[model samples]
Target: MPHEGEATPRISKVQDRGWAWVVLVATVLVQALTLGFPSCVGVFFKDLQYDFRASNSETSWFPSIMTAVLHAGGCESILVERFGCRVTVMLGGLLSGVGMVASAFSKSISQLYITAGFITGLGSCFSFQAGVTVLGYYFIRRRALANALASTGVSIGLTLWPLISQYLLDEMGWRNTFLIFGGVMLNCCVCGAVMRPVPDKPPGPTLKSCPEQSREGACLSNGSTSCHEEPLHPSKRAACFQTLQKYLAFDIFCKNKGYQIYTIGVSWMVIGFVLPLIYLVPYATLNGVEEHKAALLISIIGFINIFMRPMAGLLSGLSIFTGRRIYLFSMAAMLSGLSNLICAISSEYSVLVFYCIVYSVSMSVIGALIFQVLMDVVEMDRFSSALGLFTILESITILIGPPLAGLLVDLLGHYRYVFYASSFFMISAALFMGLSFCTMEAKNKLKETNKPPPETPSKGKYTEVPTELDHDRNGPPTVVYVTSI
Candidate 1:
């Protein structure tokens, strides 16, 4: 319980202009250079296939490991907590740059997995996640818009990278193209340099008080934050969740049900989410499309999303959709599954173009909202840990997803089945998430409806009726107050 004279605490953030805008730009570019690279990886498919003499499943492992570790930044939260975003971001850039440079010189598929998959993904995790952490803190009034704009970097990266990779692959082949890519990846250092620290003092949003968090599933809301403003001395604290929270932050799973649901659902969703992007170019090539033209099919998706992402973000931020973020996301996920069925139907340029545009719109919404939704689930400032943990859970499926898709390709000897598999995963994930959230809401409402009314207190003190043991000894009604447990 709080002392009578203490004030409520605010989580500081929101410069909303000037340096905040610069940081936002940096966040976008960091995402572009790191997260966006994977989508264009398909451009190197044929060359890598020819050089390595690998089957589809073997080839698929490279990108699978790259993307899996990209989401598997288990240590990112600790880095951000101890070192701050700027240093973490810069360090990531350096690691990724080195990884790419090493990948250029690699002689085996296994070596590329180490250099490109693990190391580069590690570095990207650092730069991308840290930049986003700062971005979340910097805006409240325009969070949706800022996130939308920030996410366009992925679209932009996707749009430009495949085209650039194609041109480079033609001129210099995959190895030298990777050498240039290493240099390009070093640009993350510049973006990281822009991730200024979030302030600890507020002109920011106040933490809602304990009284409002009466719902059964509410996370971390039952607390007197101001009462515990001073830290507990180490000797006074027991070795428990507090100790775990200080180090691993895994205690958050126990605290936040939304985080649990979102993380698990998205993990399943990712099993199919990236398959379409990975196989799209190959599918087109096999269907009599020119190699360059097939690459353009990917480029078209990126281009449409460049426009679609911000619009989705803007539409979501409107008054009518203010509380509808999850519903919107679920709808988009379903759209992603349904749209892939179009590619299964035909690979003609026009049909593929139509598919790309639809996929782009769906992809745009998912990308724009992905992190935005995470930030909403966890408490502010603790985003780094929440996200770090999320990536760890998410990375498991990411690692297996593409290779699983490739195995399907190998077994069936047809690319269309990959889309069919993708459709099932995406659509099922959407239903699970949409229904789960709706069910949680209904349960909360029922709990609220049936809750007993609070008894009025007498003479400005909270009163609890004495139990059997206390009845004989008590002179007056017992006083109790809510505690930050």
Candidate 2:
């Protein structure tokens, strides 16, 4: 006597439970490792320049090309769907590990580009996206908390990598650092292995288990009279191609207003997002701050971001603020934009640090909620497509942002223009989001006011009798229908 819609025993046995924390740890670890290496690119830039006899632009290819592949290699979502989490991440880990090791042996600038840029970047794309997809599948009620926790890996990586790179540079130099870091990334394979795919639901019973011929009175299977019965019609299965055609959609973005605004805002935000962080060191040095102080600013930014991400998640999950993340994201961006403007005017180290604090919090809010905000706006079923499309869009921005900032610096011979330009872009993105959500809210209110009240369903039987109704109640509207049992 199984309850309707209750998972069958066999199916339930395969469904993993209480392993979500394990999944979270693995996701966090891989993300921390993957992001840690890339964020420390500046440390190796000068060393690379001397070794390869490359120009600033030539050296820039190492990070720019790597980031381009990281963003533009939008294969993670598709692979996640096809190969599942465990394999996709494991493969990514292997590629990334091998790429770093190969980097240690490079002789030319082209070698670094091919190894670090295309090879390592592809690896990161797989590992990063697989980790995110795993989090989404394993947790729903605490999804934001999980995302916040995992995203701390980025800050932690940023914090840790610089110190590690500095130590390695002081001891064994750049080549050996790649050797050391490459060895470190091998742990990602272990992380990937732990991210086992959730098992599928067991198939329904065969004809022999169907009670259709066993008990005539109980076999009223096609009717609603009995709770134990199931519908007797054959359960049709769509062809694989047909199923794919139905589920895979690109036009969903155009149809969804929330997604359109979110995508555009996120794209713009990303276009200038990493620019300030990229210049923090150079900006400080230009104003006569010591190299050590410039490096510590990055550490401070990471320290604050590590704490902010989880806190924002917890706040977003609160009962009072359910389904309103767009508002929070908008405010954070505005504050961050203001901080960038402040940094532009300041020559004092203290004022610069103040701006870093503000920037850290805002950046964390943007990173922590960007994907989650998408999930809230787009239905869960369509998240795969949305993220896939989003990766393609954001990749272009990631490829452009830092270099654009550097270009501004090169053109103006000062850091001020770069900060002002980036701040303007960020502020513009924030305003777009604010107006978009406000418009959405207004539309909802308008629809509520104009729509006719639903007709109440009939009870057993009744003559019409109108009762006094209070339309001013704050709860959902009520419509009363007369009936007699």
Candidate 3:
């Protein structure tokens, strides 16, 4: 449409507004489906134990394995980069649906471990990574707010799924409940359909000099020579391998000190982070609370968590909270630890209810900002790799956390020591994170103080003066000169 000499105009796209919200909605739904069901595993604990005739620690492995695989399986981020978000998520939905259906037919604990724990967890990993990664592509300025809003889906699912799972377990037994849940999980395909990939700019031509070609064609009539333009396309198999390598890169651990500190601190924190969620219902039942009432306690935490996540997100995005989110996160972790310690000492329903409310506040604040803080520390291109490695490390804790708590319950004959252990781990993690934050700040201040000041121009060096200034002079045809030194 334009002359040969005219440069083409490229349209600039605005981010963090408009269609980005749609992507956020789809991400929320994906998270709700993936994380919500796992959070409700506690509701099925008694049913599973009764059916399998297993001990408490043995039964706890179902959720523990599922949680561990879900986190460690973040390696699925490679599939997101290679196959694209929609395909990877759709595949995940299919696997999840099939796994749930298979779990319904599971005759023993081992079968459940294979079907429910490994398959469903693997599928959830794919869907979760794709959903989380897509948000970074669509938002920049409002990234924290978007992540907060999207993460609330976890709270919503946590709140509602327990009630739904409880009703189903009450009416139709565990097997039929899993069958119906399989059908419910098929809806993840629909959510995947909504996850349209954000378009990327096409790669520009790459020029490479060819000395041999230049020498052979130096005498062209136009006196201009052609250079080779490398093709952008690669074989699909090679591309897939490259994608895997990109997401699995481990150099980030060695290159980023802040990220290293965050990873270690979070790994320690996660050892206790999920134990309370998995054991709370059982603990409540041990202390004279009814089963239904115990389930309601989780719902209460979820209800409060829903509001707290968005509030934390908005607060973290404000200027006052800028550059200080890590401190907020540390405080939240400390409060969570303190709440668990209080729970260890209390048996009254009213006291436990208050503890749940406080736990919700801390959980909301921590969950909402955890990834955002990681993004702040790592380069954007390396985020997926960083998240994958972090998840893999955290999975070690997730895998062991619940089972260890269950072991304590078995030996001590009470859940109080479990709570005490959780409180200790969380508090230690918080202190580590706080130390890392202080160290980073001190380094930044030192850098600022050591930076060299700008050099001033030397005096008595003549510089050109503007002609308009000479015309402005009215008396004695005054000649003016500017001097620097």
Candidate whose TM-score is highest: 3
TM-score versus the correct structure, for each prediction: 0.78, 0.77, 0.80
lDDT of 2 by residue, 49-146 (tens): 78998665566667766776776534665565456778888888889889999999999989998887788888977887677667655554455456
Model 3 ranges off by over 4 Å: 1-22, 136-145, 207-245, 443-485
RMSD of each: 11.7, 11.6, 13.7
Model 1, position 11, has a per-residue lDDT of 24
List candidate 1 segments past 4 Å from native: 1-14, 136-145, 194-258, 375-385, 447-485
Candidate 3 weakest lDDT stretch, 10 residues: 476-485
Angstrom error at residue 341, model 2 = 2.1
lDDT of 3 by residue, 249-357 (tens): 4676776677788889999998898988888887888889887888888888888988988788778777776667778889999999999988889877898899999
For model 2, state the Cα shift of residue 317 in Å. 2.3
TM-score of candidate 3 against the unseen true structure = 0.80
Off by over 4 Å in 2: 1-20, 49-58, 71-74, 136-145, 205-249, 447-485
lDDT of 1 by residue, 1-485 (tens): 23211212322222456678898888888888988898778988767877888888888999999888777765765576557678889999999999999999988888889998899989988887677666645554455456667777877888888889888988988999999989988999998877655433211224433233333322211110221233436554464555445434476666666667777889899899989889999898888998889888888988888898778766766667654577788899999999999989887889999999999889888876776556555554455456656667778888999888888888999999999999999999999988887787676556657986446422111111221223222111111110000
